[model samples]
Target: MLSEKSEQFLMSLRLELLKRGKKEDEIEEVVDELRDHLHEAEQRGENVDDVTGGSVNHYIKTISKEMAFDKRIIKMVIGALFAIVAFFLIPRMVSGQLDLSMYRIIFYGLLTFVLLPLELWVLIEMLKKYGNSKKGYIAPILVALGGFLIILAGEFLLREYDGESVIVMEASTIFWLGVILSVVFILVCLYFYQWFYIGVLVYLVLPDLFANTMTDAAPGSKEYINVSTAITLILTVLALVGALAFYARYKKNS
Candidate 1:
């Protein structure tokens, strides 16, 4: 029997190979071979990582390097980069607060270009390590939140050091931006036909939904506030549950 982690690694490998434009027959052959090797290693009570010779990232990099340059890989990577760039810039552009100064551009560029991918890689590793557990379901959300907080912290530090030149946007702008971003994310996930991306959509939608509800709620009314909070919490939980259920079903069927 193959271990759950080995299974997850193989699934990820399949996706990576598919992105690299491997033929279906070839992918199936590669995955079958890997599955057999992993199962044999498990039967021998050997570690999967030791048998594979490295981690999931290492496998991805090795395979990518071995393959010819793939247009699918390029398109997928570009799509992701566009999504990330649009996610941050759209709201600022709509709200008219996007500073184009060299220093400001450099600051945002560093966060977008460097730290964001680092954060994503860390989360991917965590997901690979905890795919069958609750942590796997929650790690995506945590990673998204962690990246947001890091950006905010970076902004705060920039303000403290250069108070006159910091970038700031209204809460309302962010709320609307979040709504737009949620749609973009959902579309990307649909295009990719992946169930787990729903978790990301749910996490992104929550704050904006809550903010919108709170804004519409009657001020100075404890009952209204309580109702708004309750609704937000309930909806958020339902989204998460739905996403997780779909992911579990997808995993089972796949």
Candidate 2:
């Protein structure tokens, strides 16, 4: 059995390679080879630092440089983008119509395509460096919190700006579009065997739908607002817990 430190090193190495877009099969092959080597070294009473020459990050960089990028990762990236779009759209569709403003378009575009990916890259790099320690998580958590604040500020600013409508689809069109996108999202999740995202979709998209369709409260009433807020909070908590559990299982399996 590999030591915990050796296992963490291997997991981090795999994650870095994946982030770098290395071919999945090739990455698995290299990881298996290293696992065997590490197993042998551990049996001989050597540590992970000894195997990696005291610098796992440098070792990972060297390995990443030697690996070729996977073209298929582009498809995965596109699918991820689609999922994000669907995630945002479903709630609006459920609320009755799809009224998109120019400001909302520009803001969400920059956020989803640019800032989000940049934040993910930063988090991944941070994890590669300090994933094994409790203190290492602090910086990443703070960075994530900062990103959340930026998003909240942007959303607040967006609501205040009465920008021109880029497009406004009626209820019927929006409903059909939501259905199609939801189907596509489900298919993609099923194809990837990532059921956690399905849970996310349910928690995120279904809450508004349920509040609007099932509840008797008037839309602008305090009761309606309270109920919506409560449902959203409960679902958000469930989603967070589910995501953490899923990540834990994924890490353990990996």
Best by lDDT: 2
Candidate 1 off by > 4 Å: 3-28, 37-69, 99-101, 125-145, 161-254
- Model 2 CA deviation exceeding 4 Å by range: 1-12, 35-68, 171-180, 215-219, 233-254
- Reference-based lDDT, residue 93, model 2: 74
Give each model's whole-structure lDDT.
0.65, 0.78
lDDT of 2 by residue, 1-254 (tens): 88878877887888878887889999998899999989999999888887787665688766776788999999878878877777777867765556688788887888889988998888877776777778566868877898899989998887788487777667657756766676777787998887867876777766556666677665566766677788889988876897899899999999
- Candidate 1 global TM-score: 0.51
- Can you write out model 1's per-residue Cα lDDT over 42-143, one digit (the tens) per residue? 888886797666565576665555445445656666766666666555434433244445555676788777887688677766765677589888988999
Number of the predicted model whose TM-score against the real structure is largest:
2
| Model 1, C-alpha of 202: deviation from truth (Å) | 13
Q: Give the worst 10-residue stretch by lDDT in candidate 2.
A: 211-220
TM-score on alpha carbons, each prediction: 0.51, 0.74
